[model samples]
Target: MCARIASPCVGLCSTTLGDSVCRGCQRTDDEISEWMALPAEQRDSRMVELDGLRERVAGRFLRIDDEARLEAQLKRHRIRFRPEQPPLSRAVELLRVGRDRIRDLQCYGLVPLEGAVGLTAAELHERLSARLLEEASRRRRALQACTDSHC
Candidate 1:
């Protein structure tokens, strides 16, 4: 069955048939009847039109690719105010946003970096986390030594 032309299924609702198109607002008996006769290109073109109609009736349909592309552009365009911040602070910021972005990239079918080629996002996160921990330990040790010397 075809989904409603006016509304896209957001993985919600149950149909009488496992795959029958929704019989609500947009798709009529005639549209469903002609669907099988349409050519592949025509069907694809129709699908795009149907998507817009669906969005009007339903909410926005956010494809992962759409979000990923937007996010990638945004990340590229972002201007960091404090470029001189210490590595720890930068690492913290990266951990907060970079981790989510990396996950989004992978979800959007972006090819992750090869091990020998370059650092993957996951690899970069691990390295940053380890480096931050090591730096913190060193700072603690230096502080302890300074306190002992003063005492």
Candidate 2:
């Protein structure tokens, strides 16, 4: 779970169960374990990576109109989210916690974008989170490939 600090751990970490990608924050097991120990520069780099990933996936289905409203709703609902993350992440957090109950996206300052219509909040969250994970895995592989090639 996202803490008051810059860490993205959602507290419901599944990494301790031997999962590679944490079921809660979607971070890898290594990321969760090393986050606190990582240097500021490294943590900042990881935040940049997560922000980029959220933008790519969240932008596909949601748009933010009033970031303050999104922030308010997240706080009101006790949803965990990173202040360091992009505004779009607020909407993602809304879905993550209110998947079955979100009645009006407008209330959360979110506008349903392409591929979002015809899907319930639960469905959209499912798709978005799955896509986010897929994108992360793809980027990780690409990075590994480049590193392995000594590029």
Cα-based TM-score, every candidate:
0.32, 0.84
Candidate 2 lDDT (Cα, 0 to 1): 0.79
Highest lDDT among the candidates is held by which one? 2
C-alpha lDDT values of all predictions:
0.39, 0.79
TM value for model 2: 0.84
Q: In candidate 2, list every pair of residues with a backbone clash.
A: 1-9, 1-10, 1-11
**lDDT of each residue in 1-151, candidate 2, tens digit only:** 8544477665667778876677566677767777888887898888787777777789999888889988998889888776677887657767888999888888888888878977888999999988977877676677678889999
Every model's Cα RMSD, please?
24.5, 3.3
**What is candidate 1's lDDT per residue for 1-151, written digit by digit as tens?**
9753332222222233432333221233333557677676776665455434432221211112243443444356461313332322322333334554554433432332333125555655455444433443444466568888995
Total backbone clashes of candidate 2, pairs 3 or more residues apart or in separate chains: 3
- In candidate 2, what residue range of length 10 has the lowest lDDT sum? 2-11
Candidate 2 segments exceeding 4 Å error: 1-5
Whole-model lDDT, model 1: 0.39
